[model samples]
Target: MNKATYQQQFTTEDSPGWLAIDDQLDQIYGDTEPRHYPPLCGLHYAAGGSDPIDGASIYDSNHQEFHRHIVSYGLSELYYDEEKAGGEFSKWGFELTFRLLPFQDDQHDPIWAIQIMNNLARYVFTSGKWFEENHFVPANGPIRLDTETEITGFVFALDPELGKIQTPHGEVSFLQMVGITNTEVEKLKQNPTTDAVKELIDHLKKDNPLLITDLNRK
Candidate 1:
């Protein structure tokens, strides 16, 4: 949006950025009430809770196959701050996303993915670091503790379906975190470049366009 239009629109709205995000999700999910996890108090992270992300929304997706699609809020300027009107990018310019293959246990949900996003958000908020497309992070152990899985790390890419959107606050990219094996992490470390990571993602995308994180994959 243009400078004048953006200012006129967002200035009056209580949470234009938040609404914009919801609208984008609406296009895809269409009234599907996602399983949302928010803090007990207001602005959980700011109010001193473990989750830095304001909220985490998980939806059952069947784009390529059955999976859980998780998206994070609060990584960007979710609420209206008059001072931050229409810049090049949002707060961190991106929100974390994760696509995981459905777990076996029907009794439990995939809250672990939410925790991982919060941990990453904490790192960004505390250390002033940010992630971009094709970035990789090591988990030190299996991504899901106590689980026998080869996925020990993560590599980020633009969420295949969500991609990116322009909000009244700024632009936000849905950066999806895909699970990877320790072996893949080692390969990324050897090169440490965006292209190298892209090469890895491209190969994975051939069969899995959405790059869903299958914990059982070796």
Candidate 2:
């Protein structure tokens, strides 16, 4: 379903939440510690039986001794970038971080979901993003690693009324992502059922035929 076909969800229930996602991805995000980590989103991987095993259980299974999921990625010290803005999104940029669920549930891998989202972004926007992984500080714009005491991360919403993007790190506002302005957000909030939004719905619907941004998904 496209944006128009998608029902707006005000409740915190997971059903509608999943409906808004290109793929219902919030579950694999792993709800623990500091609230946010890396990859704001994850793929649903690792399964036992036909039933799904929880993420925490998988974390404990392998780390049995460390007793902490902090270093699961194997980085001694995590570096924080001082820049927070990018390309045209500088003034409105935000950072999202998350954790890996580390367990599998017979569904699909979070990496695969990442691949899907990347492809979806390309298919929908015709712009290549969601894959331009940046290392070190961004060449231009704001880049700042937010420091908080015992604070992991949070899913940010530029315009809460529009939609969201879940990352392994945190959630970002879907509308604000592609250079959204106050005027646009206000319009979206006031008239979600407008024709322009309907057009978005149409676009999403037409994207189901599988447009390949990368052919290496094996």
In order, the Cα lDDT scores of the candidates are: 0.86, 0.24
Model 2 lDDT, full chain set:
0.24
| Model 1 segments more than 4 A misplaced | 1-13, 40-43
Runs with alpha carbons beyond 4 Å of true place in candidate 2? 1-111, 120-172, 175-218
The TM-score leader among the candidates is: 1
Alpha carbon deviation, residue 213, candidate 1 (Å) = 0.5
lDDT of 1 at 177: 97
lDDT of 2 at 122: 30
RMSD of 1: 2.0
Residue 191 C-alpha lDDT in model 1:
90
